[model samples]
Target: MRGPSAWSVADRELMAAFVSKVNGSAFCIGAHSATAERAYQDGAKVRAVLTDLDSAPVAEGLRATLRMLGTLTGAGTVSADDMREVLSAGVTRDQIGDALAVCAAFDTTNRLADAFGFESPGPGGFEAGADHLLKRGYR
Candidate 1:
């Protein structure tokens, strides 16, 4: 999740969590959601997005991007019209590219996590993992 990009670390983690939520991977969702909540220093935004995007209290660009990412994860591909929708919502080409990269990586990671039967470590472990990732990242 650590990279030079327009999205902050918290945003990227949220994207990962959203992707996992779409893929129905609870382990990935809980882990990344906790990381995102910790990085953002609040859970409200994360909870809102996880609950519903239409009124998620995030920027237009982010909502559009996340919607597109969610569609891609569910549909396995996004149409050019989807790209246009995101662009029309004010997400730049560079920003969409960055978000797409995160989506692609997490799509694979989330699938792998399911395939490997990864289990949730509960709240405390998720918090510790989040803290470690916030401090050191995924390297």
Candidate 2:
């Protein structure tokens, strides 16, 4: 999540949550989604993005980045046209790289969770974890 990219912390975290959801990691989805909600100030908004990307209430640039991230998560490759779309939508190369970094990191986290069979927390655990993360910082 460390980046000087134009994407906001909320947007980046939402992208991470989306990637986690795509990877079928409930724990990650919860953790990142709660953080995103804290930053964005709307849990429903994050959930909307999680459930559907096309109509999510986010900037076009962020939507484009999320699309590229989705492509990376699902297909393991980003097409030239996909890159073009994101770039054309005003997402900088740095932002794209940052998004890819989040995607890559979460992909590994998801696998590790599955490999070790990490148990997902209860309904309220995500919010608590988000609070802790915000207080302590990701570093």
lDDT of each: 0.93, 0.86
Q: CA shift at 106, candidate 2, in angstroms?
A: 0.6
Give the residue spans of candidate 1 off by over 4 A: none
List TM-score per model, in order. 0.97, 0.94
Put down candidate 1 lDDT per residue, 1-139, tens digits, no spaces: 6878888999999999999999999989999999999999989999999999999988898999999999999998999999999999988898898999999999999989999999899999999999999999888
Tens-digit lDDT track of model 2 for 1-139: 7447677788878887999988998888888999999988899899889889999888888889888888889989999999999999998888888888889988998889878987778768888888877667577
- Model 2 lDDT at residue 107: 93
TM accuracy, model 1: 0.97
